[model samples]
Target: MMVPEERRNADAERGEMPVVQGIPIGAPQGGMAMVAFTTLSPEEQVVLNYRLAVMCFAFLDFLTTLLNVLTAVMGTGYYWWELLLLIFLLGPLSGLLGAKHLHQSLTAVYVGFCVLKTIAQIVFAVYFFWLWHILFAFLQIWITKIVFTFCRCLSRIPLERRAQLLDLKEVELRMVYW
Candidate 1:
């Protein structure tokens, strides 16, 4: 077994940072930012993770609303392009507000529910809708399913194997849904 001094030395060698290495920046303004997770308190980390989850929930809602538009056009649901557009804009904005006001765990629950709803709705469309709808739903659900599976796998990882880039709390919060 490793001694306590050895463990502390190893951590110090690894830079003594939080296990979370921070999220990636897809834009060009990034350089070595991957090495940095904000020096925020645990509470701040939770808040940041909650915002990310809330944004994910918002995007899921927008995509679902867009699919509803497709269903309306396909004669399965009511047609309302105006409503879709309104939701496309309002959904994320409202989610942002809600994230700011609601408890993080509550927002996490909403995110989980949205994912389940999206999955169920797509499965329904695949069964009852046209070939094109089936194709669309299948592709969409496949990607979502893969992501869900990945999250579950990530959660199952031994703590030592988890990437320093990952925030375990963030993964744990999202895993509550799966």
Candidate 2:
């Protein structure tokens, strides 16, 4: 039994979701499941790109942690809590909030991530600058730059949104004339 071509095309034109049965999507084409970026609306593309970039940041943090673990195995380095903080804070928050579309909560979490990241960078740089591993110190510098970039992105939300996120109410204005 075959579905008619006209029916399928009409369904697509009417914006109906394709119904699937008995199975789910599997390993993706072109190493990704997503369609071409150009196929997405501009807004959707921006959101997707933002999420992907954050995930990549999280992945890099994990790789850094793995490097540290291996170095520790060789008795040359020890694990650091800062890497865990970076991994947990950078990627997952954006991905989760983006999916939920919780506008108010997003702003608050963004601000919190910014503050914590700033503190982490400050402490890491100040405490580790004198260490012998120049590569590690330089990596911290790069991470600080990355955190600042994220903060800048987060801060670009409208002022009204920030105020709303903070639960600030708008006051009514009244004019009195003599």
- Residue-wise lDDT of candidate 1 within 32-151, one digit each (tens)? 212223344443444444445555655676677777666556765555654554544454445444454433333434445446656766777867887776776665565445334333
Which candidate tops lDDT?
Answer: 1
Candidate 2 clash pair list: none
List model 2 lDDT by residue over 22-99, tens digit each: 112233478534222112233333333354454455455546546655655457444574345345444335534532
TM-score of each: 0.32, 0.30
**Weakest ten-residue segment in model 2 by summed lDDT:** 169-178
Please state the error at residue 63 of candidate 2 in Å. Answer: 9.4
